[model samples]
Target: MPVLSLAPRRSGFGTELLTQTVPYQLRGTTTLTFKPGGLQCTIELPAKELLQ
Candidate 1:
């Protein structure tokens, strides 16, 4: 299966972002620009190594 995308959930106020794996359906490969909690980071990871 191909790599899909990463949807990092934004934690509540004063809560630090948890480091966890968010699974998604493999549909080829797609790159998305995500900005959570006013912070931005690149979510580029291979499907086989989607683990954190």
Candidate 2:
């Protein structure tokens, strides 16, 4: 399993700041399968990122 961290953005007083906590949105499907070694893990990136 992989851990992800995100931070939100805050804006006020003509200044912008990043929040300590943010929300995460998964872009792909998650499937679990048993393997001889153990378990397999896979994650897909969002389409928006690909454009960049």
Candidate 3:
């Protein structure tokens, strides 16, 4: 997980105040399989999954 924050900008004339937050998008397929000895995990992702 991650967090993003926008800060205000300072100019010569005055200070511009700005506040915004954008969240990350996740797109994928996760699979978990159990075997005799151990556990196995697999993930399937698309080509344009992270284009957002």
lDDT of 3 by residue, 1-52 (tens): 3332332233322111111111123455545454554435465556675555
Clashes of each: 0, 0, 0
Error of 2 at 20 (Å): 23
Clashes in model 1: which pairs?
none
Give each model a TM-score: 0.21, 0.35, 0.42
lDDT of 3 at 46: 65
Residue lDDT tens for model 2, 1-52: 5433332143443221111111134344444344555545444556785576
Candidate maximizing TM-score:
3
Q: Residue 45 deviation, candidate 1, in Å? A: 1.8
Where does candidate 3 have its weakest 10-residue lDDT segment? Answer: 14-23
- Give the per-residue lDDT of model 1 (tens digit) for 1-52: 4343554465553222222332243222333344443434344446665453
Model 1 local distance difference test score: 0.39
Off by over 4 Å in 3: 1-25
